[model samples]
Target: MVHLRNRKNNYSGILIAISLVIMITVVSLVFKQIFLNRNNENEQNSVLYIQLLNKAMPVINGINYNDEVDTEENISIKGQLLKLIGIDIRNPFSVIGKEISMFTIGTEDSSENNKVVKRTLFKINPFDVNDKQINKSGQDTGDTENLELPNRNVKVNDPKLKEKLDNSKPQVLIYHTHTTESYSPYANYNTSHKKNVCSVGDSLAYNLETEYGISTIHDTTLHNAIFINSYHRSRVTVNKYLKKYKDFKLIIDIHRDGMPSGNVSALKERTTMKMNGENVAKMMFVLPKKNPHLSKNLAVSKKLEKISNKLFPGFCRGIDLHFNFGSVYFNQDLSNNALLIEVGSQYNSVKEADNTGKYLARIIAEYLHSKK
Candidate 1:
C-alpha cells in the first residue's frame, strides 16, 4: 500500500509540472503579442509605413500580388490608420503583414466621391516562378544607348477611326484600380505608381478639348473604391465601358516604368517639342505576344514607334514586347487603334512627363484628320 501511494503521488506531481509549463507558454505568447501591438503601433508611422503607402512600388521585400491584400488601395488607408493609432511602422515584417491584411479584410472608403472603386473588380496575380526574376532588367539589355530609332507616320489609332463629328472635343478615360477608393478628397493625389500616366493622360485630354476644340469626357469604369487593380486589366475594362460610343477609336493605356531615369539620348533622335516650357512627354509603344484575341500587332506597334521617332527624334523609346500581360488583355485586341504607352520612369516629375501626352495628342489628332 505504501509503495502504491508513493507512485500515485509522483504521477500527480508530474501532472502539476506539465500544467505549469503549459500556463507559462500561454502567458509568454500573450505578453509578446501585447508588446507587439503597443510598440509596433508607433512603428507604423515611419518610412516602412510610407513605403507600404507608395503606389509606385509594386513589390516590397519580394511580396507582391497577395491574394488576401488589395495592394492598389492599401496605402492611404494604412497611412491614415497608422497616423491615428500613433504607429510609426518601422518594421518591414509589420508593414508587409499589415499591407497583406488590408486587402484580405477589404478595407475601403465609404463615400460618394469615391464611387469608382466600388464599380471595378480585380483579378488576383498568383505567385509564379515565371513571375519572379532574380534580375528584372535581364541579361544583355545592352547599353540603353541603343534607344534611337527613325521616325515615321504609321497611323497609331484604329484603321477604322475617323475624325470625330466634333474634332474639338477630345475625350479620355482617366482610371486606376487603386484610385477607386478615396481616403480623402482628390485634392490629395492618390497613391499609384501610374501617376505619370494619370498626369500625362489628364493633360493630353484637357489640351485636346480646350486647345483643339474637342469634346472631352473623362470617365472611369471602375468606381473609386477599387482595391485590387492592374493596368492591363483596367485597360480592357475601359474599352468595354466606351463601347457605346462608336467613335471612340483611340484606346491608349498609359503607364510609368521603374527604370532608373536621367537624360535620354538616341542614335536616331533629331527633333524636340516643348510643352508648358518643359520638354513634352516622350513615348514608347508596348506590344503583347501570345493572345487568344489579336496580338498587339507587332507591325502596328513598331510602325507607331518609328513614326514617333521620325517626328520627335530622341522622343521614342524602343518598342517593348512582354508576356506579363498581367490579368489584362489591355483590350489592344479590341482595335488596331489601341496602344500601351509607358510615359516615363517612376522617378520622373509629372511636369516633365506632361509634354509627351500633348505631343501624342497632336500626333493622334493629325493622324485621324489625315485619314480621310
Candidate 2:
C-alpha cells in the first residue's frame, strides 16, 4: 500500500511539471508576439514606409499599379499592404485610402519649377448676388477702372499700326491659355453650346472677319489637357502662331473667370451687362507687366475699356494690370500687342460668353480702326 501511494504521488508531480512547462511556453509566445507587433509599427513609421507610401498612394487614388507585377516594388507593396491597411487580403476597399489620396494631392507643391503653389484659401472679395455694393450688372462698387501708366516713358500709340493691319492675312490672333475652361448650367461643359470658351473664340473670329473685315487667327490648342506645366506647353502653340503669322497685330489670350456660387458673400460673382435688352456677360482686360511694351499693352487695355464702356456701360471691368503676381510675362513679352481678356465667370452661360465675344470683336475692331 505504501509503494502504491508513492507511485500515485510521482504521477501527480509529473503532471504538475508538464502543466508548468506548457504555461511558460504560452507566456513566452505572447511576449514574443507583442514585441514583434511593436517592431512592425515602428517599421511602418520609418523613412522606408514614407517612400513606399508616396509610390503606393497613387495606386490607391486609382492610378494603375502596372509597374511590372513581378518586380520588387510589387512584392514590397504586397508585403506592406498591412501598413497601408491591416485587413484580410480578400477585402477590396478602404475609406482611409481615399482620404490619404485627397490629402496627398491637396498639398500645394508644384513639381514644375519647384515653386510653392499657393491658393487663396478664402475669397479675396466675398461675393453675394443681392449685395447693394454690387451693381445690378455685378460690378464691384470698389472695383474701379485703373488706366494709370506705370512710370514708363513709352506710350501705346503706334503710328504704323494702321498700315500693318491687313485683312488678306492673319492680323489678329486669339487663343485660350485655358482652352477647356467652360460654363455651368450647360450639360457636359465640353459639349454644351455657348458654354465652351472655344466656341466663343470661334464666334469672335467669325464676327471679326464678317462684320469688321478683320482677319483673325483662332488657335484652339487644348493647353490644360496636360495640367502640369500647361503654360509652358501653351507657349509652344503661341510661338508657332507668332512665327507663322508674322503680321499679327493683336494676340489675345481669352479666358473666363471663376467665382464661388450660391450666396457666398456680398460680391456679384457673375459679371453681366444689358445688350439689346438681353443680359450678357461683361468683359475684363488683364495687362501683364515686365514687358518692353508695358505702356503699349496698357494703352490697348484702356482702348478696349473705353470702347466696351461706351458700347455697353458697366460692360468693362476696366484693366486689371498684373504688376507683381503671376508670371511677369504672360506671352505678352513675345509680342508688343498682346491682350489677356477675361470675358466672364464660369457661372455665366456660354451664350453670355458668346455675346461678350461678339461685343469684344467690335471693341477690338474699333481699336484697330483707330490705329489705322
Candidate 3:
C-alpha cells in the first residue's frame, strides 16, 4: 500500500509540473506579443518602420494609415500572432513559393485611390539566347573600325502599298508590344504609362513626322502586365488599329532587351554603339521565319539594315529570325509590313536609346520614301 501511494504522488507531481510549464509558455508568449505591439506602435513613426512597411507592401504602402482599416496596426498584431504559433510572416517573398499555405491567404489592399494589386506577376523574360548574331561590331569586336554596308534595297514595289502610302491619314502605326521595357538610366520612371518604351516610340514618331513628312501614329497602350499573355493582348490593340485605320501601311513594334548582365550595368557588356563620340544603343530587326509573307518582311528589314549601317555604322545589329511561329507570331501574319525592333538592352541609358530613336526614324523615313 505504501509503495502504491508513493507512485501516485510522483505521477501527480509530474502532471502538476507539466501544467505549470504549459501555463508559463502561454503567458510568456502573450507578454512578448504585447511588448512587440507596443514597440511597433510607438516606433511606427520611425524611418526604419516606414521603409520596412514600404518594402513589405509596395503596392499600397504609400497610402496614409487609418485606424478604421488598421492596416499598420493589424500587420503588427497578425504578425505577432503568427510568430507565436511558430509562423514567420516577416519575409513574404521568401515563403511565397515554398509554402503551400500562403496560397490560402489573400493579400488585401484598402486604398482610397484604387491602388490595388490584383495579382503578383513575374516580369517577362526579355533575354533571348537563340538570337542569331551576324555582323557584330560595338565594343566586343577586336576590330575598332566604323561599320559600313552598301545600299542593299532590291526594291520590289507593291502597287497596293504605294496606293496606301499616299493616303492623308496616318500611314505608319508605331506601337510597343512590351511597352514597359525600360532603360537602366531611368529605371524609376513609371511603367504603367509614358517614360518607358512609349517614350522611344514618341521620339520615333516625332522624327518621322518632322523630318520626312510621314504621318505616323504612336499607340502608347500597355500590354505586358501579365507577361505570359503579352502577345495576345497586343494583337487586340493591333486589330483595333487595323480595323479603325484604312491607311495603315507599316506596323512597327518597339522593345528593349534585357541582358545576362544585370539590366543596369557599368560593364562593357551593355550593348551600345559609338556615334560621333556619344554612345548610342544598338537596334535589332526581327523577322518571322514561317510567315507566309516572309519574303516581303525580309525585304523591309534588309532595306532598314542597309540604310542603318551605311548612315550610322554599328547602329543596326543583324537581323534575327523567330523560328516558332506559335510562340511569337509578332502579328506579322496580320500585315506584311509589320516589323518588330528591339531598340537596346536595359543597360543602355535613356539618352543612348533616344539617339537610336532619332536614327531609326531617319532609316524608316528613307525606307518608306524609297518606295516612291
Candidate 4:
C-alpha cells in the first residue's frame, strides 16, 4: 500500500512539471507575435510619414529635416501616434492634420506628379552666342557656363532684320496651358483668375501695353480641367485666335514649373532669383525638338533668352530643347514664333511671378522691336 501511494505522488509531480513547460512555451510564442506585429506597424507608419512629407514639402517652403537629428526620441512612435490622432507638436497648424483644412495634402491630379522622361538636344548659353550640344544621354558635350553672374555690361545689338509693328493690331498672344498652376502662400489648383497663372498673364499684358507700348492679347482660358489633355485644350484656344487674327507675331503658353517629389533644394535653386534689387521668379524657355517649325521656334527662344539675360543677368535659366517627351509640339507647330515659357516653379509667389512677367514683357518687346 505504501509503494502504490508513493508511485501516484511521483506521477502527479511529473504531470504538474509538464503543464508548467507547456504554459511557458505558449506565453513565449504570444509575446513573440506581439513584438513582430509592433515592428511591422512601426515600419508601415514610417513609410506613411515619408509619403506625407513628400506631399507637404513643396507647399511649405524653407522646412528642412536632418536625417541625423531623426533619433527615436525626436521622431518617436508616440509622436507618430499623435500625428495619426491629429496632433503635431512641432507645428500648431500643421498640414498633416485635419485642423488645416484649407490645403489638400494629396496631389490635385495624378498628372501633377506624372514622370516625364526627356532628352536634351541642346542647351543655349544665354550669355554666350555659341550653342552647346547635349548628348543623347542629356550630358553637355562642352564646358558648361558658370551660372554665377559676373560684373559685365551686355548691350543688345539689334539684328538688321525688320518687321513693321502694327499698333492697331495685337502682336503677341499670351495664354496658359496649365492655367491653374499656382504658387506659394497658397499652393493648389485654384480657379480664381486673380490668384493663379492668369494673374501673371494679366500683369504681362498690362506691362506690354502700358509700359512697352506693345499690343498684347492675354487669354484667361482655363484648360487644366483634365490635366492630361491640357495642351490639347489650350491648342483649340490658340487656333481660335489664329483664325481670327492675322497679326499675331508671337504665341506664348505660360506655365509654372514643378519640382520633383521631395526635392526642396532644387525648389530653392530653380524658382526664385534676384533681378533689379528685388526678388523675382526665374524663367525658362522650353522648345520642342519634334516641332515642324523647330528652327523658327528655336530662334525665337534663343533670342528671348539672350535678351532676358542681357537685361537681368541670371534671370533666364536658359533654353531647354526637349525631345521625345511631354507635349512634342507644345502647340509650337501651329506657329513659328510660338513659345512655351515656364515662368516659375510651384514655390514662387504670385507677386514674384508678376515681377517676372513685367521683365518678360520687356524682353518680348525688345525681341519684337529688333530686326530679325
Candidate 5:
C-alpha cells in the first residue's frame, strides 16, 4: 500500500509540470501575435501618411504653353480619380488627345501670324473655324451642324480671303467710302476703317504683278459708292471687273480682319508651304457659299484646291461653306478664277503679313507653269 501511494504522487507531479509547460507556451504565442500585429499596423499607417504627404505637395512646372509658335504634343489620361488627385480639369478630351484642333475658332492668341503658327499642331483645324461670313441662303433648310468647340457665337472671318494686291504690278482701285473719322469710340482704339489703307492696298498689287508678271486692273469706281463691307464690295467689285476684263484668269479682292491681336482665328496658326523645295510663308485658300454667285466661287475654289493638292499635300487647310447668309454677287461672280485671301491681321507688322503675300505669288507662278 505505501509503494502504490508513492507512485501516485510521482504521477501527480509529472502532470502538474506538463500543464505548466503548456500554459507558458500558449502565453508566449499570444504575446508574439500581439507584438507582430502592432508592428504591421504602425508600418501601414506610416505608408499611408507618406502617400498623403506626397499628394498634397505642390507640383513643379517645366516649360509652358507658348503662344508664338506651337509644336505638336500629347498626354494621356485614363482615370477619373485623377481629378481628386489635382489633375487638370479643362478638357476631358485632351486626356485622350488635344481637344482643340489646329482650326478651333477663338483661340487665346488670335493674331494673324500667331494663328498660322498654331496650326502645325493638328496639321489642320478640326473645326471649320470660318472667319468669312457664311452664306446659308441657298440651303434647302434641312442642314444642321454640331460643333465640339468653343466660341461658337462670334462671327468667323475668312483668313484665306485676299486682303491686298501686293504691288503696282497688280494695280488696285480703292473705292472705299467707310473712312474712319478721328474718333476713339473705345479707349486706345483707332476706329478708322482705312487705317494703313494706302500701304496695304498699293503694296499688295505691286508685289503680285512685279513678282509674277500678272496685270491687275484697279477699278476705284464702284457705282460711286465709298462705304462698303466685304459683302457689298463683293457685289460692286466682282461685277465691274468681270465686265471689264474677260481674259483675266484671276480676280482677287483684298480685305483685312479686325480682332484682338490674339483672339482672331486667322493668325494663330503658322503654315509652311514647300515652294522651290523650301518651306516658305503659308497662305490659306477660301471659298464663299453665300455669294449671289455660287458657281463662280465653286469653280475658283475647285481650281485652287487642285493646284494646292498637287503643290501642297496638307497645305490647303480646307474650303469652308457658310450656310447662313447670302449675297447677290461677290467678285467671284466676275470670273471662275476669282479668289479671296486674308493676309496677316492688323496686329501683325506689314513685313510679317507681306511675307505671306510673297509666298502666294510663288505658288501662283508654279500653278500657272503646271497648267502650261
Candidate 6:
C-alpha cells in the first residue's frame, strides 16, 4: 500500500512539472513573436508586451514585484529583453524601430522624398536665401526677387481685440505630443525638459509674453513615456485645458522631426537654415487631412506660412497634409485653431530651435493682432 501511494505521488509531481514547462514554453513563444515580428500592424502590441514582461519578470526571476520598489528591476528586465532580441537600446535607429520615428523614411511622410508627390508649396534653398521659390511639384523656380510680406504693424482697429490682447489672458496654448524628442549633441530622446521640446516651448512662451505681448501657456506634460497611444494621453490634457480656459486662440502641438536611423547628416541639412547670419532651425506645419476644421486650420497655416516667408524667408517649410487615408485627427477637431508644428529635425541644436521659437512667437503675435 505504501509503495502504491508513493508511485501515485511521483506521477502527480511529474504531471505538475510538465504543465509548468508547457506554460513557460507558450509564454516564451509569445514574447518571441511579439518582439521579432517587425511588421505587426497593431501598434499597441509592443506596449502590451512590455507590460506583460514587466509583470512576468518578477515571477520568472523569483523576485517579489512591488510596483513602487521594483522600478529598477523592471528596467533591468527590459534591458535584458532587448539584449535577448539582439537590440542595442543605445542605438537611435534601434530605438526608432521600437518606437515610431517622426517624418522618417518609409513612414507616412515617405512622400516627401518623391518630388512628384511632394506637397511642399515652396522649398527654400537654405544656403541661398535669394533662391526661394519651389513650385507645388517641389521644383526650384530660382526667383531671386523677394516676396513682399504683410506688414507686421498691420493690426486690426477693433477695441475689443485690443482689450482681449491686453487682458493678460492666454491666447496660445503650446504642448508637446512627443515631449521627449531631443535635438543634436544628444540622443534622439531625453526626459530632461531642459534638453527636449519643452525647452523650445519655454522659449516660445517666454518670447510670446515678453517680446510680443501675447499671453501664452506652455504645458510640459510628459505624454510619450510609454511611446504608444501618446496622442490619446495628450488629447486628455488638451481637453482639460479647453474645458478650463475659454481664451485660448491657438492650440500648438510642438514636435521635433526625426529622420531614418544613420541619416542624421541629411536631417541637419534639411532642417537647418541661415537666418540673420545665424543657423536657425527650420519649421514645418503638419495638418491632419481628416480634421473637421480643416479649412479653418489650413487658412491659419497659410497665413502663418505667408507671414514667415515674408518676414523670414525659408524659415517655414511649407505645410504638410498628413494621415489623409487614416483616422489620425491629432486633436485638431476640438478647435479650428489647433496647429501641429515640427520645429526642427532631431539633428538641430537647441539654440537653433530656440531661435525658431522666438520667430514663431513673432509670427503668431502678428496673426493674433491682425485677426478680428
**RMSD of every prediction:** 16.3, 18.1, 17.2, 19.0, 27.4, 13.7
Write model 6 residue lDDT over 1-372, tens digit each, in one string. 999999999999999999999889767856665665533212334444655665767655432222211211123344545655656564445555445423222212234442213121222222432224633563423221122222233221223322323535678899998788887666677788888899999999887777766777899999877556577788899999898886378999998876544334444656767655556788999886767789998999999999888777767888888456122477788788998899887677888788787778778877887785
Model 5 / residue 209 / CA error / Å = 2.7
Q: Give residue 334's lDDT in candidate 4 (0 to 100).
A: 87
What are the per-residue Cα lDDT tens digits for candidate 2 across 207-230?
Answer: 787766778888887775523344
* C-alpha lDDT of residue 288 in model 5: 53
The model with the greatest lDDT is 6
Each model's TM-score, in the order given? 0.46, 0.54, 0.54, 0.56, 0.41, 0.60
* Candidate 5 lDDT over residue span 120-237, tens digit each: 1223455554445677654423111111122212111223433333433332233221111111121111233333322334444555566555555644323212121334544555
> What local lDDT score does residue 351 receive in model 4, on the 0 to 100 scale?
82
Candidates 2 and 6: which is better by lDDT? 6
Worst 10 residues of 3 by lDDT: 149-158
Q: Give the candidate order by descending TM-score.
A: 6, 4, 2, 3, 1, 5
Question: How many clashes does each candidate structure show, in the order listed?
Answer: 52, 8, 0, 2, 57, 0
Positional deviation of 288 in candidate 3, in angstroms?
2.9
Model 3, 120-205: lDDT tens per residue? Answer: 33222334232255554443422212323222222212232222233358878988876767775444223744457787788888
Query: Tens digits of per-residue lDDT for model 1 on 200-296?
Result: 6677777665554445555444422322334545655665656666535456666654331122232112122343344444567666565444443
Give the Cα lDDT of each candidate.
0.46, 0.58, 0.62, 0.65, 0.40, 0.67
lDDT per residue as tens, model 4, 1-372: 999999999999999999999879654543343344442233233333443455557665434333212321255433555544556566544433354333333222121222223221222222422124432573432221222323333332233322344566888999998777776655455677876788889988887777666678899888865344567778899999898885377988888776543334334445666655556778888876667788988888898889886787777887777443346377888898898888877666778788877778778878877843
Better of 2 and 6 by TM-score: 6
Evaluate residue 6 in candidate 5 and report its C-alpha lDDT on the 0 to 100 scale.
95
What does the lDDT read for residue 203 in candidate 5?
A: 49
Top candidate when judged by TM-score against the true structure? 6
Off by over 4 Å in 1: 1-196, 214-216, 220-240, 260-277, 292-299
- Model 5 poorest ten-residue lDDT run: 67-76
User: Which residue pairs in candidate 2 have backbone atoms (N, alpha carbon, C) closer than 3 angstroms, thus clashing?
Assistant: 127-265, 127-267, 128-265, 128-266, 128-267, 162-372, 194-350, 195-350
Please report how far candidate 4 places residue 41 from its true position, in Å: 28
